[model samples]
Target: MSDASAVTVAVLDDLRQESEELDLLVAGADAARWAGPTPAEGWTVAHQIAHLHWTDRVALIAVTEPDAFAAEVEKALAHPGTFVDEAAGELVALLPPGELLTRWREGRDRLRAALGAAPPGVKFPWYGPPMSVASMATARLMETWAHGQDVADALGVTRTPTARLRHVARIGVRARGYAYLVRGMQAPEEEFRVELDTPDGGTVAFGPEDAPQRVTGPLLDFCLLVTQRAHRDDLAVRAVGPDADRWLDIAQAFAGPAGPGRAPKRGAAGRGDAE
Candidate 1:
């Protein structure tokens, strides 16, 4: 395995740990709370967890049996994006909240082990292309952290980013290309110099010494803002250079076209406007 591959594994480890943290945070909530509104629009935290567990199952299936991916996506797409809009409300309405959490915990653990033990060199077919197991793992982390933040926010809790968030930061950096393309601009070929503050009150920086594009902030802040899991005003990321500034304004870690992008103003009202 190469360095890049190791990064994915590290991200997987982060997901595993974060999954446990999320489980603890959401434990023992009432059905109504489960049904309570989350920042993720229609879906509640329960729905988000279900989706994460679902992806683990689907991704593993794609790895173990590559031939079935296309057909599976057809079935998977039946639920729409993350299936929260489809099943979470129903799950919250029908099942006991405890049961739902129990199911999600079991599913999350199973998927964790499955990915860890996934057959080597497997490239799970995704919307983009067949991604190596490592990429799949990173995707899992990104999803877990992004969605978990939703739950944390709903509960008025602050979830800090671990050192492992370097992976998420990296994805946000690379996805600048996608952001640019979505806006009908040629993808910038220049690399980004990313800097994130760590959980231990330290800063993490990446890329070349003189990289023109740079992202600097706390890892949690950067991860949350870039994933669109949270608004930019919540974080204090400083981006320099014209291209870097625009990309940061719209950097999306997920696979998709750019939606409306908001530049973080120094002072805006509300929690989202916090600098």
Candidate 2:
């Protein structure tokens, strides 16, 4: 049995730290800042945070009522197109600032324990198939890194992806096929290598060495852009060759509709690779 405890622990800690960081980033910003629009359509900083909180609420239900819980998510998404905005507003206001922070911390702690104790074979109906607790924890970490990008951008704060976020990047790289299929593209042939810049300016390379396609850049930037949190235009990531470039274009870090992704824009300056 793959014990997911290690990752569960890491994920929980990352969430706690970033949540605390977000509190710091948004603390001085005005309410308008919190309510500021993010790249996510119909989502603001508050809405993204609310989405995290709301997800925590639903994810808690995963251990037992996974199916029903996911269905509720579907129902929520299925609401009339315009309702997304209205629903986001309602959810964003669901918690008072302090209470939300408290719950966010407490809930993630509980989440660690839950994931650590989860049976490897327990299946989540909506997510489909039984997942080991490792997969479950990784999934959450993926969510945190992606959404945290939303908060970081709204504040114009450049967030360097931490070493631990590699787990998140790995998840994104592994999702390549799904990304292609999602975009109605033929999953490419030709093996590829992902050469990513670590949060500390080191490199972690994945895939076969001989692979012609290589993705190289700050790991955090790649993850953020891939997951649709930070715009590709906002980060310094390079896709060598045509196949690699294509992946960057339609990379969908989350499991939803193909989002609006564009070419690299004039990204603001940030800490360069320490190396």
Candidate 3:
């Protein structure tokens, strides 16, 4: 296989692993547990899985049928805010916990298969922009991990950080410009240097060594920030330049309008302000 093909396969594998990990967390959940609230306001544990299932089905359509995917995009455009929540809420209301879990598993399996079989160099439609197979896989992995964090938190379980977080961190770094653009601000012309300490103690650096703007912190913390899973005040991530600092306030890895990030935990040291 070519290098690009190999990388795509690797990302697909990671996406599968990430999904399975979250699956294990919810596979045996009871109704009460499924109804448990997560960090995302008004989103239950079941809602998290339901949202993933709905998105996976949508993504499958995007990969398999572009014409149909256009319709899905139109629905999103028609009700950008309520569309996602409505889908998940409907799923939770219609399906029992076990059935919801089963459907989510099945849908994700189909999505993985569709993505794996897609032709090379073909970009698929998405809520924001078109994405290659690899980009789609990485985005899936990122969402899986982010939502998985919610499930883990609701269950009062602390998951061990894994190298899979590299995918999430990479997206966070690449979405720097999108973060600004979504907030109606222009992205800085000069790239910012980002150095994140990986889970295993090594560092993964992005951008140039001599870049004027810099962000440095734990890879997991950065991922949490971009995904809006944790309040920035609870994280150790620090930015050096003015733009870099502002970027942290509004950073988001996912598409759509800017998210209402989690508020700082009570009594937590405030890390300035975030939007």
Ranking by lDDT: 3, 1, 2
Candidate order (TM-score): 3, 1, 2
- Per-candidate TM equals 0.81, 0.78, 0.96
Tens-digit per-residue lDDT, 9-95, candidate 3: 999999999999999899877889999999888999999999999999999999999879999989988997889999999999999
Candidate maximizing TM-score = 3
Question: Backbone clash tally for model 3?
Answer: 0
lDDT of 1 by residue, 1-275 (tens): 77755655776778788778888887866666666677766667677766666666666677667787777767546754544345445555665767777777777677667677776666677754467767777777777778788788877788665766777877776667777775778877777787777889887777787886676777877887778875676566777766666666678877644544344444544232211
Q: State, as a TM-score between 0 and 1, how close model 1 is to the true structure.
A: 0.81
In model 1, what is the error at residue 101, expressed in angstroms? 2.0
lDDT of 2 by residue, 69-106 (tens): 76666765677344445655776677655555566667
Candidate 2 structure lDDT: 0.67
lDDT of 1 at 35: 65
Best-performing candidate as measured by lDDT: 3
